[model samples]
Target: MVRISSFGVGGKHKSTKFALYCVGLFGLALLVDLLWASSNSSPSIYQSIVSQENVVFPSFAQIKEEDKKKKDGIDKKRVLADNFADLDAPVLNWEKMANAPVPRLDGAAIQIKDQLFVFAGYGTIDYVHSHVDIYNFTDNTWGGRFDMPKEMAHSHLGMVTDGRYIYIVTGQYGPQCRGPTAQTFTLDTVTKKWRDLPPLPVPRYAPATQLWRGRLHVMGGSRENRHTPGTEHWSIAVKDGKALEKEWRSEIPIPRGGPHRACIVYNDRLYVIGGQEGDFMAKPGSPIFKCSRRNEIVFGDVYMLDDDMKWTSLPPMPKPDSHIEFAWAFVNKNSVVIVGGTTEKHPETKKMTLIGEIFHFEFDTQKWSVIGKLPYRVKTTLVGFWKGWLYFTSGQRDKGPEDPSPRKVLGETWRTKLEL
Candidate 1:
């Protein structure tokens, strides 16, 4: 039988055991050196990667805050505050004058010599004022008052004065979102007589009207439906409240059409500025045309018509504005100053907001800037420039500083010196 020793082996076995021990020691030393090197270099490597990428990793709290702001509909880009401080404009000191006899909205005003004539307007939801209220700037009091013609419109009328005569055209006759009338009339301030003129081919609400050259031009308002934008442009030749043309002439259509736009003729150029595309409409099949606010877009679009009779687009207002209509005046013979109006609705609440800033559009630069701010935000205010002062009266005013939504119909008149 072959016998194996319990403890003894050949010389080859001893050499193999020694070689295995040496290899195990070397592996242990290599592993320890690798771990030490990794520990020393890890922080520097991480910092180098961050610096090269220029990345800032937001904390969990910061991420949450950003998400909250987005959900609240707070756009950091859309600013609603008055920016008059940023502009180089004259300082305005506002003073209160005598209030009108009645509060009204959507009224037309024209200055004739020392007197300001305020025409028909909306008194309440169901009532409309057809009286002509006159204010005397010289006496700082409400002067003579007269009733408009029985057939004349109550609100949304386009009015422009030529010395002694005030032309009234196209408007909602009654109240509660009624359709507009095509009937046109002229009022002689001296005789206080109403004369009929050629009716508009198309009826419009709060159209832009101006006496340009020898013809009276009317453009851009809401249609008879009271919501659709009207783009038709019409003109009529007139001399002393009499139409020289048998029928109204059709001119080039405006690029964009809407109501409550500020239209003026300056330096023989006709300009239309700051209007809206949509408006409050009547409910379907309602007899009285119950007014309901609809989805609308107010804009700051500006257009000019020269002797070429072509419409030219100009720089828009600093922001989208509407409801100005008569709330503009010529200042310094080089710029037009527009007062309180409406702007974009709140992003989250979707409620309409009123404007308080006075907008200045420079004819020379063809630019717009915020010159001053009103005492309170309002819409549909009547504006006039007389004797180096800017006068504004009668409109719907905002609720308060916190709430920009219109609340009260105001008849108070206010004015500020035109320093610039």
Candidate 2:
């Protein structure tokens, strides 16, 4: 972990010129008053106009913190208050599932029939993982272990399942995030092998992927090796067998979806939330310096794409506006739940802090419910919803602040029953 800090400085600077103008106006008023007093006749019309203008005066007083914060376009109160899940809030029964045979962060999970397949992602060994780990839902234990093609050892790749085949999109190959690969493959759950399939229209890392209504959706991730964001939306029609001659087509939206934002499918609508646009790695673990595009937002912007391809911006998540990346999951396309991710790094210690607060957004009310806090600290993790269970795995996690232990995840997978 490296210490990250950003610097920015800007202001209107009109105060100085305005003060000079006010001083000149005051001097003119004094001269006019002297002439009016010396004259026996009534004051001039222009002098009367000056007197009226003088009445528009206000006393200089100290500005409150809240008022100042409001002027600065930030609500510190809301962020500080809503950053945690209450200890006494609520919790459904959560039990440990089979420990992840391949525990890695930034990977993905897909359930087909009675088997759950965990795909490639960046691992704790400081390398990208191509090893495939599977767990059987019927047997309640780990299943087959396989390896991805050497070139497909990609991390941060877009992954989605059509129940039979898991489509693995482009992602970074080496430990560094720069080596984004264009090789996409599909895994057969029944055969336990991967086959070459239709690659993406363009190459990108960390692109959001979802399967809705027989169409595969990939949108809102960085392009050009994770340097810039493009509003390219690509979809492919998947039939029984894997065949593609004219399968992929791209459409440019009016306003592009958020780059690197957490995306999920809900209620037949595609949603992207709270992700950095240009670069998610330029200043990893860095603190925000100014209000601009360079700094990744704390709670990320929210958007929903309609069937007509129109994008609608929704209310921002009510969490601390730090740059640490978080994760979200949807329970049956109805309720959206956000869980563990890192918070802002401590200034002196320079350790990137963790967020314990868990929240569920209320659609009808436009508010967030501080549901409950996680017992452990999380930096990066995958949220997989299979059947009635929610599986959490990977991430550089640790014990919470109260535990006084260095925060880290020991590479274990756990699950809890989520009653939708």
Candidate 3:
């Protein structure tokens, strides 16, 4: 019959079709939900790639502005940290060495190997040291004293060394602000004997002196009056501790001239640094040349003489400094370290002030920095550098931290490792 089997097969086919339709509707609903969620929240993979391509970056001007702000912040910090009185500066660890055999001031010191030779200086208002005091760096003691030539200047002398020979140039021959002597001499350290050189054509007091290009060059000192600034520069050919020329040759005058300046030859170039425009002069017609302070201007001018024998003005020190004729050394072969010296007078008190800050000058950058302070303020401190150590022997000390006036001459020796 039309049969129950055929009807059962058609019914099964109809149920299968309905199930397929229901599955299609569910899949469409899930796909639509995913599309709506992506549009409202997290991007789909295709949408993310398109967004990345359209992303904006900062402009060059904006980047520059940010960099400038950073630099300004750094500059402000540097300024805040530059105070000289700040305790965070480098520690010198200045250990006391042997006191000098005698107190002195305005002396010249030179180091040869393990020995430090202290030359003529002012011992007192009336007395001047006529002996050379030799300090043995190895033993940390003074030894092997010898008398300077009776004719040699006893104070305010300019001294420089080349090998075993020490050249002593023009200076005040006696105490009490006496006139300078034209006489110049050389002493052989090996023989401990002195030889006379042709006298400086013009006598100078505490002139800047150095050996450069086989010539002994001298410049910038007080004239005969002891107060007039001398700008004359002279040189004489020298070889083997002897003069090659019979007379001193004239060179270009220094722009400014005075005593107590430091001169050095580095990289075949000559440099002159720090001095005063005037000095104490002898009262007119006074016997023994009684000394009295005159109007003076401490200066920090720096000059460099090049291979072409032309001088170029260089950047000056932060403050005026003078009386540092021998208070300097070449450190690390790239910079100069100047020790204690005299600075500008106090603003209100009008009294002289001593410099305690260690001045560092860089040859490469032609810049200056206050590296450290001395144990106490001082002036005319004889300085020497040996085997990474800095040594200062004699000087005039300040009365106190607040009092800028000089108290007394000192013979104390101090040493510290060369940290900078």
Using TM-score, give the best candidate's number.
1
Ranking under lDDT, best-scoring first?
1, 3, 2
Candidate 3, residue 66: Cα displacement in angstroms equals 44
Instruction: State every prediction's TM-score relative to the real structure.
Output: 0.81, 0.67, 0.78
lDDT of 3 by residue, 1-420 (tens): 555787788989999999999999998797667555544543333244445448433344644554575566644334433322222246578999999999998878888888899987888889899999998878889988899988888878888889889989989988898888999999999899999999999888999999998899999899988999999999998887798989999999998999899998888899999899888889888988999878788989999999778899999977678999899988787899998788766544556778888889998899998888788889999988888888999989998876657889999999998877
- Candidate-wise lDDT, in order: 0.85, 0.60, 0.84
Q: Which lDDT tens digits does candidate 2 get at residues 159-196?
A: 77766878777776666444477677778777877787
- The C-alpha local distance difference test score for the whole of candidate 1 amounts to 0.85
Candidate that scores best on lDDT: 1
Better of 1 and 2 by lDDT: 1
State which candidate, 2 or 3, has the greater TM-score.
Answer: 3
Cα error of candidate 2 at position 272, Å: 2.2
